[model samples]
Target: MKKVLIISSTRNSNLDLSKDIKNYLMDKDELETEVIALEDFELPLYTPTLEEQFKSTESFPKNISKIKDLICSSDVMIWCSPEYNGGISPIVTNTIAWISRATDDWKEGFKDKHCLICTSSGGNGKNFIKGFEMQLKYLGSNVFDRSLIKTKAKNIEEFEFTSVLTDFYKNIFSE
Candidate 1:
């Protein structure tokens, strides 16, 4: 069975959201699902200096390898995060930076993988969805066009959530 990796950037609402998604997708006989909260990992901010230091010492954070392996082993990824300043949250970006740097190929974890961007944010989350979609596509992911957006003013309806996930599942696994 293929694996579905749900990455949550926060431990609060976003983590709850990731769990919901995992529960929804868990029954699929062809796939196994797991949820990971980025907050659980201790990753330093990515900088050329820090990268050099890690490279020189050959001691990148242990969590980086764990995350990279999860991403690389999975066939699909569901990204759950909150918008920060009309963009991707720092944790999501930081995780990606570490993963990219830790891998032999920068896109090793993302290339040819299927990804669905989701958010539970204070705002509408359009910028986050669009911006992260572009970044994931650049890294060689097949990003789903539709997203699951739950904002403070508007929660995702049950039917809509199911529909989006159904469509995304078909998109990734269609024969």
Candidate 2:
């Protein structure tokens, strides 16, 4: 079975959205899905000095290892975050920074993995989706072309959500 990791950058609406996606994928015979909220893991802000300190000790924080292991083991990742000031949230960026520094290969957690980006934002969220797509691609992920956007003013309808996920699943797992 393929491991599918759903990462939510917040404990709020985006986490709820991640759970909803996990629920949708739970019954799929070929997939084993798990959800994680970044808020649940307390990580210090990433900086060159902090990273160097950890590396000097020949280790990273336990939470960093836990998240990195999850990403490295997963075949597919569905990322859910809110747009903050027309860009990706700080937690998402910080998490990636730590993961990159913790791994021998910077892209170890993301390379060749299938990624589907989703957002539950107060804003339109287009900028966040587009920016994150580029970043994921840079890390060597096969990012889905379409994003699932759920803004506070306009929520995602059931049909649209299901259709996008169904298409993404087929495209990723087809024989």
Please report, in order, the local distance difference test score of every candidate based on alpha carbons: 0.91, 0.93
lDDT of 2 by residue, 118-139 (tens): 9999977999999999999999
Q: Clashes in model 1: which pairs?
A: none
User: TM-score for all predictions?
Assistant: 0.97, 0.97
Write candidate 1's Cα lDDT for 16-97 as tens digits.
9999999888876788999999999878889989999988999878888888898999999999999999999998899898
Measured by lDDT, the strongest candidate is 2
Per candidate, the number of residue pairs that clash is 0, 0
Q: After superposition, how far is residue 148 of candidate 1 from its true place, in Å?
A: 0.4
